[model samples]
Target: MQYAIPAPPPWWSRLLARMSPTEDMPTRGRHPRALVTPHHDEPRPTLAELYRARRLDMVRLALFLVDDLHTAEDVVQDAFAAVCRHHGTSLDGLQDPAAYLHTAVVNAARSVLRRRRTARGHTPPHAGYGPPVDEGLLLAEEHRQVLDALAQLTRRQREVLVLRYWSELTEAQIAKTLGLSRGTVKSTASRALDALEKKLKVVR
Candidate 1:
């Protein structure tokens, strides 16, 4: 007897599309490889330039991780402030400022969640988040459903899924950012995807 594989969800493509930043957002923010310009000897972007290019993108990322629009914006702002405090406005001596900023955003979001957990006593950090008001970050109903599913995942699972799919980070990069082994990132992503799909099926 042959067993048939289950069909993937019809909205899977749309879900991925919704997860990505807009097409016009700078590619350098997500892919560190694009920062290399040794052949042409281009100067690295200043911290201000990097912030202008990547701030919104990072906010979108933090939004997914924290599931609150205002809190997400604050998280990205704090990340930038932390980077500036450490590396200066010129971002001198930083091998990869973009990657550094990304890590900072993730860490800041984690801190926000941790504090909420301690104060709220078992409530998820995203609980009672208001609808997003930013026009640039607005989502369709289907996309909101996807985000709701993501909110149900554990923090590590959410981070792995967002970094893997939304930011399009390689497993090695994710491992370094999250301080996890590559094997753990791989397994977490697999399990997260499975859980998310089940949640989406229920939503449908």
Candidate 2:
């Protein structure tokens, strides 16, 4: 008797955590019963390949938010493993899996922040230092200045900016992902932009 095991709702499971959803539908491979096998099934090759494909990008993004490559890698790897554990099969159902993954990465980064806080009571990194880049060409002076401005913002402002402008997520999506009220998200984003604008004007 091969009965299927139903997983929890995708939203509540925290499988992808805070990473943005994927741009394309992730393939979980074909199972005799369904396109995606249930949670208990061994991880399919498609999911593994999918993780491999996205791992590097996720690491860079995580590094931008968390400021440590090693920790970022762990976050990215955890996200992949989670997708395999909880949503591996259902990832194919997602419209924008890349965005989903983005949310997950962001969440995992937050968890990392919480853990770090508990351990060392350190504050999050400043975003106003420069636009985030992953192993790219050296940033120009202006670029460094931009990041410096971003770093000066509160963590809320920086997160809203990254999710809204950098990730292109909607206010509704950002609010839901961050477990905040939609109005709060909008206000935070507005304030963040306002602060950033003031700094940019001064820089110019």
Which candidate has the highest TM-score of all?
1
What is the Cα-based lDDT of residue 25 in candidate 1? 60
lDDT of 2 by residue, 1-204 (tens): 222212222321231343333445232231122222224344433565556455665675666566555677889877776666666654655444555667778878888868876755453555222323652232334444555676578767777766665444677778876777777887787677678768867887
Q: In model 1, which regions exceed 4 Å deviation?
A: 1-12, 16-41, 122-127, 132-137
lDDT by residue (94-145, candidate 1, tens digit) is: 7777668779999999999998778677657677446657733566778788
Instruction: After the best TM-score superposition of candidate 2, give how far the Cα of residue 45 lies from its true spot, in angstroms.
Output: 11
Q: Which prediction has the highest lDDT against the true structure? A: 1
Q: Which ten residues in a row have the lowest lDDT in candidate 2?
A: 27-36
For every candidate structure, what is the RMSD over all alpha carbons to the true structure, in angstroms? 5.3, 12.8
What TM-score does candidate 1 get on C-alpha atoms? 0.80
